[model samples]
Target: MGSILVVMENGTGGFVDSSKELIAKAKDIAKALGMSSVAIGFGSEAEKNLKGLSVDRVIAVSNPELTQYHPEAYEKALAQVLQKDQPFLTLVANTTMGMDLGAGLAARASLPLIAYCSQLSVEGQEVLATSSVFAGKLMAEIVVPESGAVISVMPGQWPQDTDRGDPPIDRMSLDLPSSMKILQLIEPEKGDVDITKAEILVSVGRGIDNPDNLPLAEELAEAIGGVLSCSRPVVDAGWLPKSRQVGKSGQTVKPKVYMAFGISGAPEHQQGMKDADLIIAVNTDENASMMDIAHYGSTVDMLDLMPALTERLRGE
Candidate 1:
């Protein structure tokens, strides 16, 4: 059996949610393939962050320059590791950093790269993968034709590893080439109510009509004790923050209850919310695809129903 090398970002703190999910998927895939799985971390304090994983080993490329995430440094270090390990398959989380490094590695190494993979399985020498297409309206299965395949998986789509079995983390270090220089690091803005962890979500759409009309949606969300989210149009119209946008370009939410109001389900918007356990759509149009997929739906306008529902919910 060949070795499976899983790449971990090992961010400033511990591993990010996506990286943790990658480790979990790597372990599961490795077990299925009957091969050993190892997690490779590239950061200055990687050992402190990645030592908690249940993997067989944790390889660190700890250097001061490696602390901040830069495309050049990451590509150079990871490419060297890939060449050295020569594993059967390399797995990375489907995040901005992971995708960039995965693409760079694929180009430099001339390996088959599968990006944004939703599902993966091993079939003999082939690593079969499935990607959601047409805004997650369809599933397409594919196989990497190259010997050493590189795959980047989407976060929150896979579960994280919790169990710690035998064969504790074997810490190994790697020396990197001093060609690349570390530059300034810029921190991005943070979002409120990280939708990835929220079990309940109340999503609004164009049905609300105007920014002034959002009080009702807020009331519904308040009654339900969950944050209010919306479609791209609502966020684009300044009715809500971009963080609250739920779609392919926005956040992918897998909430326990995804209540959609006035939003005609577009493929791009639906893809992000399709994983919700129970979907409820409030739309007058009965023929809407949202109603078809929604476990519960109402034919009346959310505008008319909002006040009464809010009052009733408040009364109860």
Candidate 2:
């Protein structure tokens, strides 16, 4: 039986959450296909982290040149692993590093590549993956025609794997070319507030109309003792900093209460804040995607609603 291979990612202290989520999905696919799940990671620290994963085996590829993430170096290392094992399915996170390496690895291995996969299933003998299209207005189901297919799974679509057991670790090495090197790692500016830990989030989107009206949302958030957050458009428009942005490309937040004002609820934005305990959305369009996931929704104009809501919350 062909094995399911998962490419693990390295984070500050351990593997990233997306990597574990892919492993969880890979385990499910492997079970249905009657195959074993194998995980390949880089670095000795990654080997220590992989010991807790539930995969059948963990291959840790270590090299001096791989101390940091270099796109070409990763592509070369992954290509060597894929060439040797030739697994039925290869899974990577649809993250910055994953997207960088996924296409190159697929082309190098001569396999089909699927990206932004939110769901995967085995239909008959073929593996089918579902991904969002058209700004998440539609979902497209893609079928991998043959084995050795590579897929980049989107984060937050599946629950993270919690099974903690020591998996057998296999050590390996790679000779990376000196031509590939990271010049520098420039980190983004740290925001004054960390929205990820906010108990309540009052977020805005394009529906707010203008950046000049941001104070209205800020007033409401302050009244409710909540942090001010926003969708990608708000950040893109420069009304809010990227730290305030909540979405797949921004921050994944799980606040106790998420109050969205004038947000259209695109899948990318929803993936970040969908796990909130209480979702309350206020949009003029009652049929907005935000309303679909909201526990309580109001079809009122946010321009009029924000001031009144702020006053009411302040009065209480």
Candidate 3:
């Protein structure tokens, strides 16, 4: 069996949480397959981040052209590393950069590509990867028969392994083409609150009905000393900003307690807050998808329950 290759990404401070999740998963897959795991880093900063991860080896691809992220440059550099290493399974985080890089590398190498994988395992000799489809309504398992396959693992699916010590880093020089140049990197506007750091989140969904009903959720959040967050629909409806949205496309939060109101529990939304210590979901429908992962489920009307729950918490 060939080695498992994890393509890591660096963020503002160091490695992104998704990259750490990939590294942990990659280590598990490598151990299961009786193969070593190797992490591929782009630059010096990435190398520094990769060192702290628990992997067999870290390959740092350094080049002046690799400073800023360019899709073509990343593809070319990763293609060279892949050709040389030829790992059995290449993993990348299912992030913005990972999505672009994974697709480009898969296309460039003509390898099988799997995206948004939440679960992975080895059944006999076949590599099975499970991902959600139809907006988290159905789960699809992909089987890769080829030796070299590229998989983009979703963020927040696997927990980060922080117990491991620093691994040895090997520097590789790559001759990148000067065709594509990044002119400027524009950052998104910052939101009022960073929901990712919130210890408690009172999240609402489309079931809230009207924008006027938002104050009820806010009152509940405040009553419990928690922050008010929402699903994607709430943000789309202009009831909440994008910063307060929790899902795969939004913020990934691992709060101590997550209370869901009127949320159907789509897979995209579940991926974000599923790791919370305590998940309590209240919806009209008992058979809703949100109930599937909730620690405690309530089949009560959220509109009626919110006020009462808030009042009870406030001892009013």
Candidate 4:
């Protein structure tokens, strides 16, 4: 077994929180398996960010175009790196980018891919990956091969590794695709409260029914001093901003208390807020996925419960 390679997710000029999460997990696995952990990053942002990272070694593909996310270039670059190093386990964040890149890399490099990995451990030089299936209703365990495998770790499951050290930087380059270019990139608007930092979150899903009912959830949040969050459908419906959305495509949150109203708990949504201290899910369907993970679950109508909870909190 060689080293564990982590494909870090880069942001504007630094790594994202998920990037540190992968790094943190890589350290844990490497320590348990007696293997070194290597981090691979892209472009100038990564170059600046990778220097002080606490890893055995860092490989930075210092191409300017690689700063942002170029699917073609990234797949090709990572393919080349995999061919040369062949780490025992390569970890990538199961993000929007990782979902696409990991699949492509697995196909091109002929390596096994374990997606939606929530837990991993080493057993006699073999890595056992626990993956969530059927939107977290079931769990499947996968064993990595002797040759190697690619694993996309679910975000918010692991803690962020902030320990910094000067790691040796290995520079590299490749034939990046020139056909595709980003003409304009617009960032999503920020919300007032960062739900990730919120101690309590009142999360809504498609169960909220109509936009007019948003005030009901808002009232409940205000009464409890919690922030208002929603699932992907709410963001898509323009009922909430992207910053307020919690899921794989949205923000990952681990609040002290997570109150989910009308959310059916898709796997993506689970990845965002499943690690909360306490989960209270309210859905009409008793068999909803959220009910399985929630500490307290209710089959009562969300509309009816929202008002009652708010009125009780307000001492009405």
Name the lDDT of candidate 4.
0.89
Clashes of 4: 0
Q: Would you estimate the TM-scores of all the predictions?
A: 0.71, 0.89, 0.83, 0.86
Looking at candidate 1, what is the lDDT of residue 166? 46
lDDT of each: 0.77, 0.86, 0.84, 0.89
In the range 185-245, model 2's lDDT, one tens digit per residue, is 7654448789999999999999999988999999999999999999999889898999888
Superposed Cα deviation of residue 171, candidate 3 (Å) = 4.3
Question: Which residue pairs in candidate 3 have backbone atoms (N, alpha carbon, C) closer than 3 angstroms, thus clashing?
Answer: none
Residues 199-286, candidate 1, lDDT per residue (tens digit)? 7777888889989889988887888787788898998888788788887678888899998988888756775898799999999988
Model 2 alpha-carbon drift over 4 Å, by segment? 64-67, 164-170
Residue-level lDDT of model 4, residues 279-315, one tens digit each, is 9999999989999889999999999999999999999
lDDT of 1 at 17: 73
List the candidate 1 regions with Cα displacement exceeding 4 Å: 165-201, 206-227, 246-256, 262-278, 282-294, 297-316
Q: Which should have the higher lDDT, number 1 or number 2?
A: 2
Task: Tell me how far the alpha carbon of residue 142 in candidate 4 is from the true structure, in angstroms, after superposition.
Answer: 0.8
User: Model 2 clash tally?
Assistant: 0
Candidate 3 local distance difference test against the native: 0.84
Query: Which of candidates 1 and 4 reaches a greater lDDT?
Result: 4
